[model samples]
Target: MREYIESQLARGRGYFTKEEALAELGLSAEAFQAAIGRVKRKGLLVSPRRGFYLILRPEDRQLGAPDPSRWIDPLMKHLGLDYRISLLRAAAFHGSSHQAAMIFQVIAPKQLPKIAVGRQRVDFLFQTSATFEEANNPAWLSKLKTEAGFAQIAGLELTLLDICRYFHKAAGINGAAQAVHDLGKNANPRILAKAASAYENSAVRRLGYFLERFGHNRQAESLKDFAKKAKSFKALDPAVKPLVAELGLLDEKNPDWMLIINVPVELEA
Candidate 1:
């Protein structure tokens, strides 16, 4: 059983389901259960989630965790989820590596339970919008080369917009502002605008505020136009509660864009 599992892993498969193991190991019903139990006891395999077991190399057993990126594809495939890696993880892939990502953030079509791998956390944020469907091309998802194969990650522009759309889940407005400032110059304004359209008006307002502050004038203006058409005012960062008191003197508003600033944002000189 161990040799067979290792052979499959050697062939570049990162993980397997119980059924796959049963057929490949050529074990009788009673024997298959025993084989799995033995391998698991030896730490040769790990079930990151139910019904999914990852093949562990000898070194991996010592470390006690496989690289989540390596096995993420198979796990998602087993669960039947079409997920796109996003946020700081996507930012790193796109060239903004200032902040190390603590969580492996993913956008899934439906709700998914959180997954823990060693010290790393795989968080699945659900998107209910039908219009915000994952794109099938390279324009939307950048390929991440893994031991298994390339994993699909959100594109640079999409990552920037997502950082704003989910600013609260991200590193608040201040951290997000820094990330936007870092990624702004390299990203295409039109692509950013297109991505922003998929989100709510509040997200548009947040994107416009940051883009404008960071010198992406054309992009900021486009997002501002969208914000003007929106019906409500939104805070630049939603996580900072007691909004007005938090900003104090820094609190201000862009009436035209319908955004209430509740935090101080300064771009790098």
Candidate 2:
């Protein structure tokens, strides 16, 4: 039985309930505790949460805590708010290495709402909106959300916007830039444009500027569209029109800000 548990731990599927362990080990609950204690003494598992045990190898957790998605799902369903992990949290899920990120950012689309778990680093954000922000992308739901009501995952542009809102924070700018760089290869024109559509959004404009410097063409164009959709830049942002004009990117048909936001990078097979 110990050998079998060790095998499952090798596969990176940690997190099992008491009953699960008992049945798997063919032991009573009391025996299960003894077994767990033995495993703990051997340094095979770590308790990321109470009653939850995960086998630990070098870089991955085995029998890790239940998927963050599983934990947040019932809660979100209870609140009836469609949410997803956004910003730094999403970037981390996608595997961009960064430092100093402690809270989980969640988005609902209408307004920014936040919750802080006591003494735990996990945090939550829910956008209070007339309509919950929705992600048609299935990948967003399954892999991006986390365990702590942290579910709202933002599109690339929205993430940039999300980051800008928190730019005043210490890790905000670096975290945001790292995210952009991580996705620098993935920001397709359409997704950027959609995310840029929320133009009353000041931080998004900053992201657009950053994209321009970094050569995100699609994102640049989306930024331009965001400006145009808002019906002019005089009061919204004085620099916007001038910047677009300097780029000579005005297209009555498709006035992208001319960012060329993505540059392709090869991934080896």
Candidate 3:
């Protein structure tokens, strides 16, 4: 079993499924399970998902498995799921490295529990297939090369919008603001406006507020027309409880973007 796994690795394949192993080894189900179990016990293989196994090279043993970026493409293909690297993970790739990404973040059509294997962790954020397809414009996605292969990642504009849309998961409003501050330098105003059109108006408003607060006025201006059209005001940080409900005081509102500043945002120099 070890030799077979090694040969597969040699052939440039990093992973295999249980069915493939059973067939290739010509073993009964019970026997194959026992054989694979032994390899796993020896730290030669790690399974991030059921029925799938990743062979660990000597260099990869320290990390317990290959970096998620190295195999995410093939793994997503194996599971028959469409995905793109997104949120904080995608922001880091775009040079918004203010906050280190603690886990790999992915956007997929279906919801999934987090996957943790050794030191590697991956979190999945959900979107409907229709919504994901509509937002996954070719111009907003890019192929990023990794040690094992290439993985699809959100482009600058998409990354910024996704971070705001999922701000709670991306480390709240301040975290989202930090990413905006870092990424704002290279943001293309025209492309950002086009991308914002695909997301909810609230997220567009939050993003615009962050951009203006972080001194990216031009980029903020690009999103102004779209944000101003929002039917209602949205909290700058959706996670914060409304001050109106707590203290019976109206929250400071940014009329330009129509956002209720429910939380304070602090940015680093």
Candidate 4:
């Protein structure tokens, strides 16, 4: 059975499940478990999560893994869930690499338990399936090939809106602003306005201000146009405390965009 498993892996298969092995090779449950234990001890197999295993190359045995990007699609498929790699991770995929993300962030229709792959972590943020269906568009997602297969990540426009909506999880306004500045050129004006409108007024304002800062006037104007009907102001970073007390900055706010300027920002052309 060990030789059989090795033969299958030698054919270029990089991953497998106990059920697949059992079904294909007709191994009894006890035999399957024993076979798995043996390969694991030999450093040929690693279980990143229960019921799934990655076939490790001899070199990878030292690190005890392959890239987690290779496992994301298979794991999500195993769980039967919809997901989008998002936030700063998405920014990196779209070519605005900021600080390398220590944790891979995923937005799935249902909350998935956290997973650890080698030294890296995969964290899932939950959103209703309904919301995911509504916001998910082909234009808003990109398919990039990974070590094992492909992973779907958010596109630049949607990533900008998402980072602002989940501002606390992303780098603060400064970081978000820098990403916007770096990736702003890749954003499609019409698509950006539409995506921003789908988010709350606060998200719109934050994106609008950042777009303007980076000289994306057309996209910024479109977001501002949509924001005119809004009735309230949202702090630039919702996670931040009031600046007047917390940081001694004046209680200055941008009336046009209805964003509280808790921290001062300077931008140049």
Candidate 5:
């Protein structure tokens, strides 16, 4: 079992499945389990998901496993799920590093629980198949080079929309604003408009508001038609409680984007 593992590592393959191990070692189920247990006890192997094992090299042994970006592509492929690195992580990759993400974030077609391997944590967010498919267009996604090859990640425009769409998870509205502010300098109005068309109107409205607030008037203007078409008003920050109603304060609305300002947005300098 150890020799097989060594050969796999030599070939630069850092992960394997239980079935592959059984086939390669020609061991009975009980024997295979015992052998795996022994290696795990030595801190040479760790499994983030059942049946899938990550082989830890000497350097990685301290972390208990390789970085998630190095192996996430293969892991997601093994699990038969289509995904992309998204939200704050993707935003950071696109030069919006004002707020570092504490956990890796992924967007998939279905809901999934957070994964913890060694010192790493991965949070999964869900999008409907249609929405995910639309946003996963090659134009909107990019290949992020990693040690293990590459992982799929959202482009700058998609990252902005995703941050607005999942503000609660990305950080609060202010964090989202900071990210928008940071990325605004390089933003393309047409591409931003194109990407916003793929998401829900609520997120588009919020994104437009942020773009305009941050002085990206051309980008903000590009989204005005789409925002105007939405018949209903959405809150600027969906996660915030309706303080205006509670305190009997006048409801503040941004007429151009048709968004209710339920909370004050202060961007990080």
Candidate 6:
């Protein structure tokens, strides 16, 4: 019964699955179909996905009305990304309140799976291990990093270094800028040094070169300096040297937030 569904949901986190319905309502196959059909048509429950449902109340979706956009969060939990809406997705979430929620930005390690939840695409990025300093700065970044598997929260400086390093791969330069400019001090250096020590490649050096440009007297600055001293990619890894050499370094100070490294224009910019 509707009263039973409400009573059952009232006790927990406001979500119920088909199995939950089976246990509570004891509906046979046809009865279950009719009950679900009635609730959904009345706009009292929303089907987030195939079997999972959320009690929409009067706030968002009407009861029983399935909103495909609501599928990403639960999907993320199922995949163990422990993801949050961050980066471009966060910006979009902030920027367009009325827009359809298709794309979700999240922060999880590289080990997580990539998924296209309905129309929204969920992506993943790898974060390096962080020291004590990087973890507590950006309220959002810190909280995001602490989400289950992606717990190595980097400081603002370390995050900036990472953004610059993976600007092209993770969120691109704009995402990198958003990661850095939104937060103030967490962009420290000592955290980045540890990252640099592990991220030995041309991509990292190019990012390090740019980040070293914006760096203050932080620990990552020293690490960036060391990364710049890598001379050529050949001295580092034999495999990535050629790719590193292709993306040249830029020393000119331009707030353009551009990637000076040369890649084909058709590449994901």
**Clashes in model 1: which pairs?**
none
In model 6, the runs with Cα more than 4 Å from the true position are 62-75, 79-85, 89-103, 107-141, 144-171, 195-203, 225-269
Rank candidates, lDDT, best first. 3, 5, 4, 1, 2, 6
lDDT, candidates in the order shown = 0.75, 0.50, 0.85, 0.76, 0.85, 0.46
lDDT of 2 by residue, 94-159 (tens): 555562334555565444344322222334544435323333244324344333333445555455
Q: Sum up the clashes in candidate 3.
A: 0
Top TM-score: which candidate number? 5
* Residue lDDT tens for model 4, 1-269: 56666766676667877777778889899888888899788878888778888877776666677766777887788778778888878887877767356557888888678876566677788767776776677777888686556888888888888877776667767767877887887788888876664677778788888888778887788787756876877677655555454666647877778877777554323
Off by more than 4 A, model 5: none
Candidate 1's displacement at residue 123, Å, is 1.0
TM-score of every candidate relative to the true structure: 0.89, 0.50, 0.93, 0.88, 0.94, 0.52
Residue 2 in model 5: lDDT? 85
List residue ranges in candidate 1 displaced over 4 A.
28-30, 129-131, 134-138, 243-251, 266-269
Candidate 6 TM-score, C-alpha based: 0.52
lDDT of 1 by residue, 7-122 (tens): 78778886888888777777787987788889888878778888788887766765576767787777788888777888878777777667567567888788888887555578
Tens digit of per-residue lDDT, candidate 3, span 11-78: 88888888888888899989888998899899899999888889988888987888888888888888
What number of clashing residue pairs does each candidate have, in the order they appear? 0, 27, 0, 0, 0, 17
Task: Output the TM-score of candidate 2.
Answer: 0.50
Clashing pairs in 5: none
**Candidate 6: tens digits of C-alpha lDDT, residues 61-164:** 42232232344445445444443344344433334232223434345543555544223355666553352223223442442321112322333444454445
Local error of candidate 2 at 263, Å? 26
Q: Poorest 10 consecutive residues of model 5 by lDDT?
A: 241-250
Candidate 5 on 1-269: residue-level lDDT in tens? 78989998888788898888888889999999999999999888999888889999889877767878878898898899999998878887888768676569999999998898888788999999999888888887888887678999988888888998998888789888998898875778888887777798988888888889989888888889888798977777665546666776437878888888888788665
Name the lDDT of candidate 5.
Answer: 0.85
